[model samples]
Target: MSRTPSFEPYEGPAGGWGSARSLGNILRREGVPASGTLVLGRQNKVDGFQCVSCAWVKPAKPLPFEFCENGAKATAWEITSHRCEPAFFAKHTVSELLGWDDYHLEQVGRLTHPMRYDAASDKYVPVSWGKAVREIGQTLRALPDRRNVVFYSSGRTSNEASYLYGLFARLYGNNNLPDSSNMCHETTSVALPPAIGVPVGTVALDDFAKTDCILFFGQNPGSNSPRMLHPMQEAAERGVPIIAYNPLRERGLERFTNPQSPTEMLTHHETKLASQYHQVKAGGDLAALTGICLAVLEMEDHAKQARLPPVLDHDFIDTHTHGFGDFLGWLRTQGWAELERRSGLSRSAMTATAEVYARSKATIGIYGMGLTQHRAGVETVQMLVNLLLMRGNIGRDGAGICPVRGHSNVQGQRTVGITEKPELVPMDRLAKQYGFEPPRETGLNTVEACEKILAREVPAFIMLGGNFVRAIPDRGQMEPAWREIGLTVNIATKLNRSQLVPGRISYILPVLGRIEQDVQNGPQSTSMEDSTGCIHGSRGVRKPASPHLISETRLVCEIAEATLESNPLTPWKDWASDYRLIRKSIGETYPEIFFDYDQRMWEPGGFQRPLPARHREWKTENGKANFITPKGLAEDKDMPEPDEDALRLITLRSNDQFNTTVYGYTDRFRGIRGTRDVVLMNRSDIARLGLSEGDRIGLRTASKRDDVRRELGGLTVVPYDIPAGCIGAYYPEANVLLPIWHYAEGSKTPAAKSVPVHVYRGPAAA
Candidate 1:
């Protein structure tokens, strides 16, 4: 039933006519040709719902078409005319649906009603909301321990819903609340607080306009966050240097043509983005960053000896930072040979990059999962901070470290206390406000939760909005372990692999999407925090896909009310009816941050959360930004050197995909079409493995452990412009090869970016 993929080089600029055509095709295919256009026009507007895509901040001043190609796809995907009602589910068994791919599962369309899995029939049947809630509540209450339950959240959930979900978990008994952050930017959360006294980015959207230089490390703005290309284009036009480092030279960083620019579209002109591009090897970010920092130190030493101006910012260092002398000593001890070998970049390239950084008065460092999804993810982020600190890039206009977040409200979900660590949140304040003893013990994160599930320690799993089974690593183990649970509840907008792989007692509760009207007491609005720490309002304008759908806020409240004994102090019903009450509670709970949450939502640009680091006021225990030195040049010191036959594998997302959701088979930017089962390898590596361009290859995990043997086969080899020792494959599909235990040291984020594997010219071992 699948079409064979065709491979050819793509020679078009990103986001010009190609983007427009893709958007048109998606809109038409989704059956929202005209209506999708209207919906997209309102996205990111003052009164419009936020685009349910990336967390790129909206400009203070609006444009006619602020939405990008991926944004249009997300909106159309949500507001499509196709429906998956009870009748549709009744016709298909869960076994049958499990055979379908992710795209087809979602393409079947939005869920229409609450459905319960019927074990006897192996099908789903419509169930009344009242009965479903009551039974699920009773089942949860009957669990032996609250710790046996895991509550997972997605980035798409609104702040109001996320807050309530957190409250419900704490009130129920444990802090077993883990969200999407555990898999993506958990490294940013873990690494930044010690270095800069903040877990989020310090720079605002306006900083892009005034920045002297932009340094991108392991990020592709063109596909991950297309809206970011607009700012990069402006910076490029202004002649600001943009230096990029990644294993793959992403087209978004190479050249971009804004679809909104009529001049560019008519003239077929493209703006070159990255002034200098370095294809650093996979898992080489830490060494590469160290090399750059060492170059800066050398420049400073030379400047001091020659009586020229100093390159390093001593004033900022002396006043606001600690451990500089120790860090410098450790940094100088690192040899250039190791750095060059690990980074897959020449010393000249690193020195040149440092020269650009030293020349610029203000610089911005931007990164994504490529840096955060490695064993040394935390260390790599710290090294990046050290690089910025060398020139005093933090807390100044047009300068800061930016971690490009994936989901719209991923950062917001963390801000609202959707975390496994209770100490990170205000447990005392929550207990005082709600009249309940909140749990203080730590809970399970994504990796730990799966471990517990595999051991049969977990009894129930409740997801707010994500395809947990698909997105998490080690699908080979997780999918089967997930089915062994006692209860599984999925509150979502559409059918996904997670829903199909049901537990003993599973329920699929359909909820309203971001683009749909959420009316409770009156027309309501929810808030989301952007990647840049800006919290803004999002109001839906379109009709709901089905009348049976309920708002996430109401659903969370109903489930909480049904599960727990009536607590007048909590007032679940009152808060559910009016979201303003929830905001009031949030304001009271975190007065320092959300004191005037509702009033500020109507402001010209909403409101920016107070970032102490932005004011150079460190909030760490020592009240100073600290320079933490990593152990060695290698990001993952524990990872053994790969065999000569092994190559590092990096999982990637196609241009047509968002996270685990695949919209289509085509990866426009990468020149991949009609298939997701291909491996992109360097020409030299392809030849070294005795493989041709079109050879079907098998990849086996090079993990040291012998108990588990993971292998992926039947992948067509496509030569790419990547580092000689690395290969690329699409995510989720490649997740099977990744071990559940292989994760970042401090953050425990799955090390999906770098996995040692062996490539061969045949089928996989059974």
Candidate 2:
């Protein structure tokens, strides 16, 4: 077991010691840091694999060190020399492994071969590819109602793998294709397309250099996407104003020391990131952003009265947008008093933010899960877009909307049709091109999938990649519900906790990681779509960890072949042999964007998928950009009043961890070390609750649903720079306190960042 680390106040910038420690962790695990550098250096390059970390856009000109701390760690973790053979599993049973934490279980090593759970032996045993696939195929083929099976995709799977996976699921029967995006960016996907007619972000990475201002709403690029720090630093040096809107004062947005700069490395210098920071209350971004828009309107009226040029973009509104009059009418009716109360910020701050937006000719807005994982997540995303549309920021240099994606290919997965709703992709095209009738109905999302499993409606669960149970809320219900499934299949590199909690029958299919080469078509190349809508080729550099491992592309094809009994009509074997064939099929599927797929991906910077909004050509129902005018702020009127002792809970990630993947129990940026069981609160709240900084406290959640007691016990309190009524804790740990139904209304994403709870000085639970 790993020893608990010690904590100290981390006063240094983000990329110094914390970065060094991340690389050192790989060295300690591999006994040498030199081995992974060559592979890491090639990340996000022309002939290299995509970074298996966050989905920040790669620079047009590749940096010398394109990989960040977490990117390197993912490499080191995947390319380690150690192995988890069948003998290892024979020694330790699934029950025994379940007792270990996520870090300890993954650190055991990678699975070397396909394995199946042996009920009598109470351990996993090695099984050949042929037998395992055949058995699984037989079971699936025997099913009476095919909708009982659900396929889950992850962000790490390449585009070719994802396209084939989606096609297979639809052809087989149901459109029950849930992906990691369901839990992360489903709000962005659902909200953007209606207003702008495209779900992808409109901004390119190159836009960072020329934007006059940047408004960051609920995102922390310094920790989540470290590569973003370089461009942000450049923009900062260029005197581009940056405005930050968040509930807590994130260390990332405060400042950054670019590790790549020689002067900063030598002199320990830092670059200021956020020029203006406002701590918007929890679930208060909708009100705050609306206030900014209101301020812009007020500025325009004042300019008109003074006989100055109009602040609004009349040409863009007249030519490329709709709903302006209605939006203007609603803006006039808004109450500034209620907005101030809901936003937790004075009118001065909101007006100041609006001045920055109005004066700047072009601005790029970047956001993260902070705005999306809420009761009105879709509203907040659309509102941010509405603010940009007023100034005609959509189709200009250094101006557009950017939602920093969490996974490397979360956007790509959606691009290639890994969605539960297949209506987004034309069914006629799929049917005509693939020679199969595809399912047209909407299917279960991540939340609905869990609910189906709980109700015993879904019998089989096949995961392409991901830590399923660990990333969701209501873990107490999800864990037991997973076992009710008839079969569970996992395709993964590392041994995650999800594999331990299995259905009645389970199988573990070892697959090649992105850094590992696939020899099926003589070093096959995979493609991915970055956050900026750029599609690039990604070819693995390292050899497979074990010879038994198969590529995800080939594995999906084999399963389909086995289940369908080798259909002559389907070109599964041909497509599996050469990935270019799959690319050809993908081009035919989405001709407008993916035309000449194999050749276009070979370009040095890769090709960007055509964005209609980027050219100021809105493809909405009215064929113009929309100005969404809601009835008013729903969260403001509908949000229940918290008790005097209640605190609004915001779940966060430690700097040392990824989504559900714990690199270590240390958040060095936050001065958190040695433990994940701690709560961050304001000093005033600690005093009000009669608790000390290191006091062990119990948090009882305030929920309107579910009668079960929801509490987290024995948490150490740490003083943080945040609003008094708000508190923070690491997610998945606090996920247990959430009721299953506490999610966004339209998107169905769990409202992980905003939960109502109260801290008490009482007996600890754990």
Candidate 3:
């Protein structure tokens, strides 16, 4: 058994509208005077920052208060008055700080300077920016091969920086880009390109405005992506059907009391968000989606005999799609009994959903990690596309696939070429445009990189910004694998647990945050991509928080210079100081898409990257969109049952937190105050286990042949209306129960949502 971590239980606000008020309260309670407070304005305009929470596309025109509850907390957390100056570091050693919880380590405030971990002194001492970059370059030079280096891009990176970073990595002679998306929506990336000839969302923000009905599958927009609530509110008010399907009954999906609208807030009025909510099983999404499609197919057959309009888009299928006969055959073989058992939805419920979908002129399907994080996640999304295509929903004003991303620029990063595998055309074109041959050999993804770290194959690690160590699945295995790497360099705005993983020689270099000014040696602006595939400019107005801080663009360039040594790749000699040359290179490489990127960005906001959906065009290999099929219903491996008393546990994020970092502890949405110890369980499950609502339980991983045992103890079980046979707990803490090898069958994304175990009583649970 792995040793239990010695730390306080995490207690944070459940991410939502009330989180903003809670954060403001915490700041005041902590004696950070209100007058000194800096409340950044709403998102979508100047002074308005991107919500640090989830990715909900910003409206073209700002709302009364564009910021949502979690977004407000994210802004306040970033603009907090708290600071972790040099004196604070002097008071605590790295070992001492290691004793602190993840929340305490970050809550102390932002780092003030470049720092290196001094092993002898056991504290992080400030280092100069020049020296820090030089050290990173030196480490890279020492690596036996360029392939030994792994470059990770977080979703938080702006488009311009991501472009520059990708260019630098390719120029440095490697394509080991294991990005944040791999951990979240790689399923969409892998499945979409094959199904639709695109790897990103096909829908745009304007498309939502035209959509008559939106089918939300396995998503919790209210807490996961609150900004979606605004669009959902608009659709709901317009009498559009918004059907939601998920195992858990998220309060955000039921109704939203918009804090942005004063009228609703003042009168305690709430807008009914979901037209119908279906409680599907944890891994039953694919069954539910297919069942809906089957219903539609049946309707289409009946309509044809009645001499009514063909329910299936015969014109679309014949002209712009393929594989219809094969898909139809598969649907015909599926029985209602099998569908109902796999989907956990009653036939009446399925019929209700099909009625909304069949009646709608055009419908939009939106899903989140709940669908994409599973073994059949990719196929589940493709099934939704199949249903939409039955009615010719693609290449229309109000339709297409919309995978709600968690990080802000996840989709953007993929668009700008942050990937382990780049297509031959893009790579060959890049080589032709840039003077160097791009690497042909595909590189490692998130799962592969973790294995490489464990095998001690990757010699160096460079992270733009992400709490990787904590964010990855299987904490016990990940921590040890992280320690085996030769070097780990982090370009960050603040220190995270990843910094202390002890990669032979490690450095945490401070950089400017998005809300801060980014002035190169010359005047230049940076570009970023939004969730909807819109590429725009991001200009930081405020000064860098500290004098020593540098922009990530300059730092990555310098590291490239240091690592390449005497054989520098291109005109990178001055690229660090001049960002326009970088933009110019990006345009040259992707001319058809990023044409005149520099000039176009100068206009109001920026320009949208063109897509076939926007112009109703299909760019598939067969000259038409394809109907894809799944090998199976789902892919989570069933574990052997433990003793009757044991329970399986899964982890999730709270409202006051993003990934692993905590801003404060108070889950207002669940009505639990000052605690992360509360476990969400079905009332029936509680009864079945002979446990009361407030009973304490110990969660243990089912025994395996490998002898790797995980137990998370001292959890307070609070009966919730969650789907039966499933449980929800906060992450990093519960991450221990997830096995590294227990991930998606093809995508390799850790199944953080469905780990099977035994929940029982006592300190043994801990």
Q: Which candidate is the best by TM-score?
A: 1
lDDT of 1 by residue, 1-766 (tens): 5787899888998899999999999999999999989999899988898989989997778789888989889999999999999989989999999899899999999999999999999999999999999998999888878876999999999999999999999999988998899999999999999999999999898999999999999898888999999889999999999999999989999999989989999999999999999999999999999999999999999999999999999999999899899999999899999999999999999999999999999999999999999999999999999999888999999999999999999999899899999989999899888888999999999999999988988899999999998898888888888889999999999899999889999999999999999999898899999999989889998999999999999999999999997888889889888999999999998888898888887665568888999899999989999999997766554455655688999999999999989999989889999888899999998877788998988888887654677888989899999999899999989998888988999999999889989886775631
Task: List model 3 lDDT by residue over 449-517, tens digit each.
Answer: 887887878888889998888788777777877777878887776667888776777788878777666
Ranking of all candidate structures by their lDDT, best first: 1, 2, 3
Please identify model 1 stretches exceeding 4 Å from their true place. Answer: 637-639, 763-766
Q: Cα lDDT of all candidates, in order? A: 0.91, 0.85, 0.74
The candidate with the higher TM-score, 1 or 3, is 1
Judged by whole-model lDDT over C-alpha atoms, candidate 1 comes out at 0.91
Cα lDDT tens digits for candidate 2, 200-225: 79998888878999999998876788
How do all models score by TM-score?
A: 0.99, 0.97, 0.93
lDDT of 3 at 594: 81
Collision pairs in model 1: none
lDDT of 2 at 485: 87
Error of 2 at 190 (Å): 0.8
Worst 10 residues of 3 by lDDT: 1-10
Q: Which segments of candidate 3 are over 4 A away from where they belong?
A: 1-20, 26-39, 46-53, 522-524, 565-569, 602-605, 637-650, 703-706, 764-766
**Hey, what RMSD does candidate 3 come out at?**
3.8
Candidate 3: lDDT over CA atoms? Answer: 0.74
